[model samples]
Target: MGNTDKFEMIANIYDTSERIQIAKASSDAIREYLVEANSKNAIDFGCGTGLVGMNLLNDFNSMLFLDTSQNMINQIKQKISDFNIQNADTLCFDFEKEGLSDLRADYIFMAQVLLHISDVELVLSKLFDVLNEGGHLLIVDFDKNEKVVSDIVHNGFNQAKLTDIMTKIGYRNIQSKTFYNGSKIFMGHDASMFILDSQK
Candidate 1:
């Protein structure tokens, strides 16, 4: 989960075509479940280079692009300046090391982020606390894949198991479904992605 240096090193070249396409798909999936978002604040949790958040600027009142890597945050800052986006800000914070400090949001979404966390339940609980009442948490990630194996990240996640974990964390009205499938999407193997929506 401590891949801060790894991400920082690639921050400049992270927005490749494949990643951009995935981010686009993720954002579209998130938009489907977003409700009354025009006047709400959002946090793009673990927002890498602001790919997903950038596409969602017009959907929310304000967006906070948050990442653990300063270089990643810098990349987003450059984008924010280049696009003249006024309602977006960047933050460099690590939830696993330091809990979200009074940072609350009406909506929080993470794309392909939960796979990297070592303690998923703890992080989910922290996010739950950070969300405002009646807010939503949207997660876009790879569905369970048995073909891929890795020590640094999970192969994928079982939707039912994840829902159970979120329910235990006090999230309600949980729902999930597969949305996108692509080649070499996860660990060089063809995989499908799912979007899960939960309310606080």
Candidate 2:
């Protein structure tokens, strides 16, 4: 499926997805990055159904919930079911399309969504452009996506390559860590995170 289709599809079920629930370690990661976020302003790129956004509602001052799928954004609205979303706004966008100017944010977040991009260079470059001075970005997903999912998904920016691309974009404090047992067995949904801090 294309990026737009991801959320339209995920939006239907992401509230329960293992990735977005803010696990203990995952929540710790988010808190650490966001504490340095400096501003409550945030942008959630490819925020399918806002599942990740829901976890972060308390973290941001105002949120520009962005996705390529209008249907997905609509699904987010449907999924959230009327929380006090006054501080929330939605935008239809594709990272490769390069129109990231609706609003700038101190923080940019992508969760369970980064690997679905084919053009990390363009997207990260644009993200760097849109970031406020001393901003940060937190991206969370599997270092290894499922084979079936990968076959149909467009997840090209794997961890090592992604770290390289973000560094090329001048994003600082780049770190990547993988989480899994020594067995290397798939536990259905495992935890892995890449946290990037924008020094621009």
lDDT of 2: 0.65
Q: After superposition, which runs of candidate 2 have C-alpha atoms over 4 Å from their true positions?
A: 17-28, 36-39, 79-81, 145-149, 154-160, 179-198
Local accuracy of candidate 1 as per-residue lDDT tens digits, 1-200: 35788898999999999999999999999999988899999999999899999999999999999999999999999999998999999999999998767899999999999998899999999999999999999999999999999988988999999999999989999999999999998989999999999999
lDDT of each: 0.94, 0.65
**Can you give the lDDT of residue 123 in candidate 2?**
77
Best-matching candidate per lDDT: 1
| Model 2 pairs whose backbones collide | 40-61, 115-155
Error of 1 at 130 (Å): 0.4
lDDT comparing candidate 1 with the true structure: 0.94
Clash counts per candidate, in order, are: 0, 2
